[model samples]
Target: MTIKEFKLPDVGEGVAEGELVSWLVAPGDRVEEDQPVAEVETDKALVEVPSSYDGVVEELFAEEGQMVPVGDVIISFRVDEEGDGGGGATATDAEPADAQPDSPASDGSEPEPDAGEAGDDGADAEPDTPSGRTFAPPSARRLARELGVDVAAVDGSGPGGRVTEADVRAHAEGDAGSADADAADAPEPRPAPTPTDTGSDGRKSAVSKRDAGGSAASSATAAGGPEPAGRETTLATPATRKVARDRGVDLDDVPTDETRDGEAFVTADHVRAYADAVESAAEPTPEPGPTDDAPEPAPAGGAPETATASEATTASGDETVPYRGVRRTIGKQMERSKFTAPHVTHHDTAEVDSLVDAREDLKPTAEAEGVKLTYMPFVMKAIVAGLKRHPYLNSELREDDEEIVLKGDYNLGIAVATDAGLMVPVVESVDEKGLFELAEEVNDLAARARERKLKPAEMKGGTFTITNFGAIGGEYATPIINYPETAILGLGAIEERPVVRDGEVVPAPTLPLSLSIDHRVVDGAIAAEFANTVMEHLENPLLLLNE
Candidate 1:
């Protein structure tokens, strides 16, 4: 049999190590090429490692929860003599210099058997001796000994009648322990209960002895029976329950009304009603003091003593939610970006009245071409035009070498907000695509991103980013720079406002722009100049078409 070793692949984003979360295939199982063999959790994300060759799993090298360095063998496989080109070979047959006995083969197979197992001769060996036991894998035997059990006494339960640790533990508790313990301390076996036949009985059922009572005791307790009292009960939803936990309110302590049907449940409305009643009942009133006992006078030019309330008020209308998945990922990324990037934001408002006219003029032609026109296309086109003039903004800084690497092509990243999180998909070579084409590409990318269908490569390698928060009604925001990029631009709500045109007040379309740039690569002057150039294109939209 040929054995092949499978080393851990370097999951991109420069990960050095990954934790083995789970193994989908165990030793002695058959696996196919390109089949996922194990799931690994890296610092960036969780990825599954697929088998490179088709073979029988001979051994698993890494245990679940173990952290494996990149390039380390994680599994091994044994293949047929024809070899299947999957690199299946036994460790004993052609052992690698760094091959550990438990290391995974590149072909996802098991290692060669140990010398003792290979040399053992078939015979009717002693039941108490370890050699007499059916072959147990190293891990199984180790676990058996750790649990203080004899493998030979255990029944074989695994494949090929292998004695597993579970079998050893079961036998030890069931039979072996009983024989080893002192006779007086042994557990007493219980006697089976006697059964009575209940056939064709037309008489009343008999009651248990514990339930029988005399009339005198019933009469006495009847006079002292517990009394029922009226009390208010509250209801709450799952979301409210979570909020109560965060606010230190005990749900059990909160009175709840019993339901007549199905399960007893609480509603959010009931909880709110109880909270309101408590607040109304606890309202405070002002008190008047004696006229002679006047309050102390304030000193000249001194501030008055403020009455600080010690207790905090409970939240009334707000709901609490746990951070998870993509939202959690976004939170971590924002935290890192905000702290790592020394952000310096510069804001400016630009008049886009002419740009609006220009878009209106192109709307008919764009419709004829079966494409929807939007302000984003104009913004992106302007940004790309400006980036070409100010190339520093379209670049990343390498901190390790303290050098700035300017990019030749413009991979514009359009920031899209989805239910999952904020995703940025690159629009490659924006300088080459016209306004209508760029708009279509942006629309396609945004739709795919929201659907979570954007490939890893599509979301990577962005040289600059634009976040149009105006779509959601934000006036202006200092957007965080999508790092390694040096800069990110924020487009605010475009509204028609009165402007001075030829010394006369006239309504004009205005757009608010906020530029956040990395000070490490571009200075304030350069960033401002780039923003100004972008504004110039937006003001004179004809320039975009000419370029």
Candidate 2:
């Protein structure tokens, strides 16, 4: 038997690292080749990492939630050397056996805490002696720095006594509160304090009072801003940090509701939200008019009404939700596309009376064949025709190469809104497929996407995209360009509207279309021409049969 170490493969193009979401196979489990051993979440998608050799699982080197770089040893297996010839079950990019693994485990159990990872309740060492190094996730450390809490003094409640963000917050508001109160009181003597305002009040006010005593407090302090160099402890992506520097905004001052591992994580949206809030607050407020609604006055005797549970929860503070995984990935992609490409949307209405009639006629035929037909297949056909006419619209701009690469194949991405976020599953070779074929594939892909069962490959390699906002009852929307792709088509609800025909106004069924193009690569004239070609096909449904 030979022991083989398997390195984490590069699951996506240009991906540098991935988060270990979970382990599908554990130690001592026998697995076959191509069997998924672990699930990893990359910036692109969530993918299952498969095993290369059939063998018994020996060890797992990474813990869940840990970010692992590509080419790092992740697992080990023991296989018969003679059964697989001289291949020996070693991964192509496997590291040396002597190389140190990340959070390596001897058995199917959590790794022991090292000096650097030591938490509270140091049973391994003397109680009086300091561990010297406080162990925590990056987020917890960032929170400690932000709240001015001494993490070493915080009693950890996490596994192995690791300090968490909650621990830091509690320590700052509870344990360190007396010290803060003493410091605040040292500046000025206070008269006899009320019993109601002694313990909890002093502790709770510790965080708020620091802000109140600081310059401009929250927004004003932020408006004045700090140096362009943001705080070292602030957690944000490289792109977000760059945006902060470009906007001359202090990242530390920009508030966020998202946290990672007990640290406040800032996104570009958070930065923009803060800026918008500041701008809105700075605007002048108009005097209330007689018709304006005002809050009801308190009852007599200067007393207020008792609040309900829901109201009390609302009054406490805004809830903090972690922004990560698929939603965060979607946000980053949208942001990149919006900022990188100059977009121009051309809106028009198509008289689809014939198209509607044609679909109705074919409905029975489709139903008999066990196929559910939708307007999307017809629209997809029309879009393919339009792309064939205007090849520039079916292309991508390679900025580094300074070239416009026109795609030969027509693969369309259908944007399906899932509970996690908006996911676009690609339907390959749309031009080659018939209406029935397209309809079946679209329905299957959409269903799987909503359930999050679609593989990573099904979500990539789209030449163009079609989003049906009409399904949700929208008439028109300036849809953002799907990055890399030169254009995207948004469909609006089809309804009967008054139209002019033969010099007479009559009601006709019309479909609203909004085509957004990358202005940098596609010209306005070309975009309009493409849209017109699409409408021409829809106006005459027979033309689509020829497709």
Candidate 3:
């Protein structure tokens, strides 16, 4: 069998990297050529990456939420050199450096005794695997690390005895129960330690718990302390240390079962279990009635003590979410566009009584052909006409080359708001397509964009962009230009308003327009002229037909 590595392919024109959102196929699963193996999120859109070889998946190199550069290997496949390559892959002379040979259960074959199971004299021998690592997927392993459980000690309940997330959680809970039982069987607890410091104000500060040491008796004594201090010497992974700090648990107070280099090895699970037990033991018992033992209530008008930062932090429940993927991509793009170019926005209103009538007349015809027609198609047609008259508005600024390239073809990007983030899917050759055709393409692109089914290429190569904030009942927004493109048009809700025509006041439908341009490329005067041209087409539908 030949092991072939699959690198992340370039999904768009200028995409240099992508985030591996998820894997569609797992290791050992059979896949055919051109079958989708993973979903990758590029700057433009989310795309499904397909496999290149017909084989069984061997291993995954990139984890979900990790950014992978183009041409970097993300996965590997094991292919049979001779035969149809339809069945599960068998063992070969060559093996991946990071992966071990599959066992009989993984290959769907009969089990056989391992060389380490017995010696020539029929005595037990050493194990085949020296690393002592357990079998589990990346997600399961991540869960184990988060829960501070040693996955190697957990019993796997999946195929080939693979440890799953549920298994890890179960093992952690069981370990916690065992710890509790052992604590219950210990001797009676000792008295609380004396306060070691007194302030000028006569307030007594409790001794720090971190110096209490690592014995079970010490842990029980320190559980009632006010503050936990850092340990003098604690051996733990960085992740475990972080978990301990987050839970306000001191490493010195947490008991451990394993040791490395003659030092107590602590895991996140140990810290968590210790924290839970301490919390349970620290619950205050309710007093049924007032007694001399209960402290006197604070004086009626006495001043209250100010809370410390740590106390306030614990009182307020705060949460943290990871900032990555599509949201981060949009933020970077917007920042670059805002800082790289000086933007100018021009606001205006157009009386689109004719445009409204034109769309209403064509709605029935569009519906007969199964197309959902909206005002966007008319606006797109009018925008294209305006671009033809003012070429600079539909151009790109090539700063490195110090030149402005006027695009002859009109490819307009439509800004779509999706649950993931804001995505712009470009409609190619807008000038050549008719009203119905434009509406159909726009609807299809918007639908796919929301469903995250759009390909990267479908969002690229736009000379101009249009955002209809009106669909959300917004008006006159100063939109940022899609970088490299010189301009973007924002459309607002079309509503009936008072207008004076032929020296008379009357109610007429008006459309609000806000056009933003890169001041480096198009002058203010030129931008105003382009806006005028677009408004003219909207006011007189015949002008659009003439185009």
Better model by lDDT: candidate 1 vs candidate 3: 3
**Per-model TM against the reference:** 0.49, 0.56, 0.63
* Backbone clashes, each candidate: 30, 2, 2
lDDT of 2 by residue, 288-376 (tens): 79635765444222223444544666788866466766556556777888899999999999999999999999999999999999999
- lDDT per residue as tens, model 1, 213-244: 32222332354422211222222232444344
Taking all chains together, the TM-score of candidate 3 against the true structure is 0.63
Best by TM-score: 3
How does residue 210 of candidate 2 score in lDDT?
Answer: 15
2 against 3, candidate with superior TM-score: 3
Task: Provide the RMSD of all predictions against the true structure, rounded to 1 decimal.
Answer: 22.2, 17.7, 13.7
All candidates' lDDT scores?
0.60, 0.66, 0.69
